[model samples]
Target: MSAMNAPLDLPLHAATLNPFIAQAWRERITPALVDYIAIPAKSPMFDADWQAHGLIDRVVRDAATWVESRKVPGLTLEVLRLESRTPVLFFEVEATQSVPTGAQAPTILIYGHLDKQPEFSGWRADLGPWTPKIDAGKLYGRGGADDGYAIYAAVSAIEAVKAQGALHPRIVGLIETCEESGSFDLPIYLEALRPRLGEVSLVVCLDSGAGNYDQLWLTTSLRGNVTGTLKVEVLTEGVHSGDGSGLVPSSFRVLRQVLDRLEDARSGHLLPGAFHCEIPVERIDQAKVAAQALGESVWKNYPWACGADGGLTLPVSDDPVELLLNRTWRPTLSITGVDGIPPLAQAGNVLRPFTAFKLSLRLPPLIEGHEAAVKLKTLLEDNAPYNARVTFEPDGRVGAWGASGWNAPTLAPWLERAMDAASRQHFGAPLGYIGQGGTIPLMNLLQQGFPQAQMMVCGVLGPKSNAHGPNEFLHLDYAERLTASVAQVIAAHP
Candidate 1:
């Protein structure tokens, strides 16, 4: 059925909206999330056998079944698939309102992901990734907070808007299952759905982080990422360290030297100029505002280790603003994993022939991820010390290795007003803006696809939510409030 603008004689009040959304979450969404957390629906990258395991399909079907059961007034849902690619759930809700005659009905694209990161270690004794448990108000498990709850929250928001007689624009949902693997398959799916997606005017992405869970955090910028394996081989086989100690170059040492070219070992700054870009003044100013709001918590929120003397491992900088900028606007490298070193328990006195390190390079928002990746490979492999055989294989082809970062377009006046209003109503505080250190590849694509779209990039991964790590959880109260706020914002679309 075609949408027609309906008059909202009695606007939905916060008093009514908040309780209803909260109840929906408790009775309907929470149980489904428990089921979802138990699915072990790891992303395709982590579970190369995802198709054979059927976990991804199970979760998708489960979510679709739940949405269908809701029977949202005008929602139509489908599971879109391309052979040899992960499936995505596409759903749409007809508008309860329209624009001026002859103007295109503004489309709000709701985005989220169902796939989860791998089950990392360090889980509490009583908690596990696939084991769902509710402690305090947090639902503890993998993917619950990193946004396995997105589709459920989104549908609940739409339902609340319709139930309260609040008029909304045409809303569409695009939930993908490969987000954890950098969303490599998303381009094809987006291309296939382009005609049906219409001209998007806003994107409500629920795949980001919040500063305090006190209010909605509008993601201002996201750092890009390039991941690859850097390997350095010195000899064909291991030799006795005592015999080859001075005669041969250590592979690990060679690899370390190569890495030194990329980052300053002491200051932790990326050395390459091409990997960085000047921070936008607006973002820097926003960081100051966020710094005032967060204060020391900006660096204190992390789980730092205690030294032998009892002093906790501190961040690179003690200043809140620098800590925020270092993470959000600066390029940095993390050696996530390494190979060629035997466990100490093995007690081998052999000199390893090769060393491999998994390199994860985060770039500033304006730097191109693919270009940086190619340059990164050249930086490490060129002029190898001792002419050791060195190789760098990025996640993808040389041209496009990983996801690019996103700098949000200038906020539309209506959206800025609407967001503040929603946050104040639902959270009792005005909206907060912060730059997150994570990467959501879809944001870049959506911005390019809809240059004029207003982005409401917000999420429930607040301090200590621990996304993509053990003890990860979703704050129940916060999620419920966020859902209501999302509904309020959707209803306010001009």
Candidate 2:
């Protein structure tokens, strides 16, 4: 398990290490990685009772200890407090080798979060969500894949390169714990460490995914997200359903009618002016390639209710490109949850007096966050059918970001080559580029700060990885291979 073993004499480039080093790295890391996956650092959003749970502090201290023990050549490890109450463990690993003279190499930055989504109990067989269990080549645990292993993977990759005396580029691992909750505290932490986060040229984020386990998915764009609560008051108090059936206007009905005005029920397209955006030509091309690779398995892989009409109600694009473009480059609205409504088991024969719903809006990268929010709120407020008292309050918002046109010429090829090498070594196929549906707000901010820096977003969450849902698991072999791929990217940077 030690990273200091004599470095293998393999060539540092992708073609040089392709078939052999990639497999060796996966075999070496698989066993010890399970222990790293067992920590339960559930996100603060779902684990509001985190302090009483005791896992948060344990996970942080464990990571700090791991970083300290490594003694990376010039790096300093310390657990510092940001904003007095927020505990942030900072690991500053300095560059080991001097840059070649006259070389315009920029200091590469790698970012990941240690926190994970909450895991509910009741898994099948003997599996418990918190207990790390490896079955059929998959690692089942809460934070194992979402991002817990990203920091370890990044450091391990660099260490492997260093062992070979092939380490030339400067890599800094910027690990955080609040990414799951909209990364609310990141800007503050970034400001506090402004002096130390110097001269960055490239940022590598292992927080996203590919469409499948076969290809290395590179994210070119991210959708912005806005979440808020909408409350509608229809009556002063609840009334008997039999008596109020026709007379009283139910809040649920009013809410549904208002939402219908904002979206087309059949096509799922946003109403005019809700938000404006253009789908990029590059994204459209990438989606088409991904769809062809996925095939019919795409629809069959979804874990939905049994006997559900698979293709009847579900809309399938004429081609894979359209499907991928709709998900990545377009705006979407969904009703996440409703409050003031009792479950079927607690059902009562009464018309509810008031109902509130949580709505989530995903905006295209071209739209501004605040502007989208304002447009959505205005649309909903104006369309209220029953003149119901409707109120919209912002819960959380993260702006969408378009990829900078500068770095792609250089960074994209490096990533594609690294991914192709890994995939050919592991699965005997070439890697591909794909667009993701989720948002990583910090990527846009970091890009803004260092306009000239190259950026690449890569990770291990593919279809059925179920990041924020029940039975979340990380494909063990895929993650290990991904770690090796990251190593290749760092070593191959020229």
Candidate 3:
């Protein structure tokens, strides 16, 4: 039978989420959501002079006003301040009626970042990243899918559940500004607001995604991040290549030699001691399922060069499980930037005095960030050929995170059921569980602070959403369904 004609044996309590919340989401939430996403709250990473550029403040105020207007009977909203001039907006929506003396309702903490990656000006017709637009049933905007819409979706879901006289969990939305820059200031904000946050039972992070809109992706693992600056000094100043070629060792050559020790060019395996970790069996199963869903088209979806001379070779593992495991459960390294080099223009042949590079290392779940940083520095220093003076400066780092509760038997099945219901009603497929390589440090932090909380990371950015790129967008239909799914989960929580 076709999905549209299929019967839905939804949970009795979750039925309220179907026609009522879904229709309300499409009518009341979608249009205003597009306008909310148009604001350009570019992260501090892209805009160093963020304070001077007051767009972030404007966006924060906008969010505060929206939340204040929708204030539930017992909920209160607060705009918080963090160190380094960072701003965080917190929404504390309490249960209207109290539980019995010993019985407590499960509190779900929803997390999202309001800031956006920079948007450079070039886009297809009627489709700019900052100018929100809806086309072919897709909501196109910079922060729409990545996170701005998440705040609205979370609150709307709670409202929908409450409006139906169903059981509504106490929800707190912790929205921050510096997530794109590795959440440098979040620790301070969390500490300052500890009392208000209280104890959380579940964390619903709407900041990750799947390979596509065809299925739901629950991120079970995250790769750690280690970024540092590697500097090599060969001479006090630049000298003519003809005079310095043989006499002085080139810093660039020395740096390249040091990098060669880290990864194998053919196999892409990190050298021994680069990282160590274990992959769980369930994640392996999830990867296999993801591969089956992707088919051979997975490789083609990746951004790759067209020709052999200038293109990346395909990964050796044809099985989707191996591919996904490698991405989420293993450590990898990339040279992100190079410094102390003159442009090709106005060039004379000269041997540079020094060269430096920005190196980024993705850590496995078992590795510690500071420990990895120390090992990386020692390796770089020891491997430098010809005793070339080298120094390593740590930039920023976030440790890897694996889900704390794989078998939250109650929560997992409920999410799966809710997502499945939404998919059948909208797209007609079972939701997919997956893992992401990127780091979301807040998930780990929240889990640590509230050890009992069942954390679930899900979101709307699908394949080719192009977040952090020129033409970023959020899929409209998927987003609407996602909102309804959230409502279903809130309603179904026992």
Task: Choose the strongest candidate by TM-score.
Answer: 1
Candidate 3 — which pairs collide?
A: none
Task: Rank candidates, TM-score, best first.
Answer: 1, 3, 2
lDDT by residue (1-494, candidate 1, tens digit) is 10112222224587788889989998999999999999899998789999999999999999999999999999999998899999999999998865687878889999999999999999999999999999999999999988989999999999988888878889999999999889999988999999889879999999999999899789999999999899999999999999998889999999989999999999998898898899999999999999999999997888899978999987888889999999999999998888888888985889899999999999899988888888888899999999999999998644669789999998886777777777777787878999999999999999988898899999999999999888999999999989988888888877
Report the alpha-carbon TM-score of model 3 versus the true structure.
Answer: 0.87
Tell me the TM-score of each prediction against the true structure: 0.96, 0.86, 0.87
Q: Residues 1-494, candidate 3, lDDT per residue (tens digit)?
A: 43234356543344555566567557756766676677777888778888888888878888788767776565778888754566998888776557878875667788998888877555677788778887777778888788887777888777777777776667788999988777777878888877767667778889988777876566776777777888999899999999989989999888888877787867778885647677777777777878888876555666655568766766557766677778777877777778889888956899999999988788776566667777777888884688889888776534421111222112345555655665665556776677787777787677668777775678887777777765677887777767776766666565
Mark the regions of model 2 whose C-alpha exceeds 4 Å error after superposition.
Answer: 1-39, 49-54, 84-86, 99-105, 120-126, 307-318, 397-427
Worst 10-residue lDDT window, candidate 3: 401-410
Q: Please give the distance, in angstroms, between residue 148's alpha carbon in candidate 1 and its true position after superposition.
A: 0.7
Superposition-based RMSD of candidate 1 using all C-alpha atoms, in angstroms:
3.9
Best by lDDT: 1
Residue pairs whose backbone atoms clash in candidate 1? none
The per-model lDDT (C-alpha) reads 0.90, 0.69, 0.73
Which 10-residue span in candidate 1 carries the lowest summed lDDT? 1-10
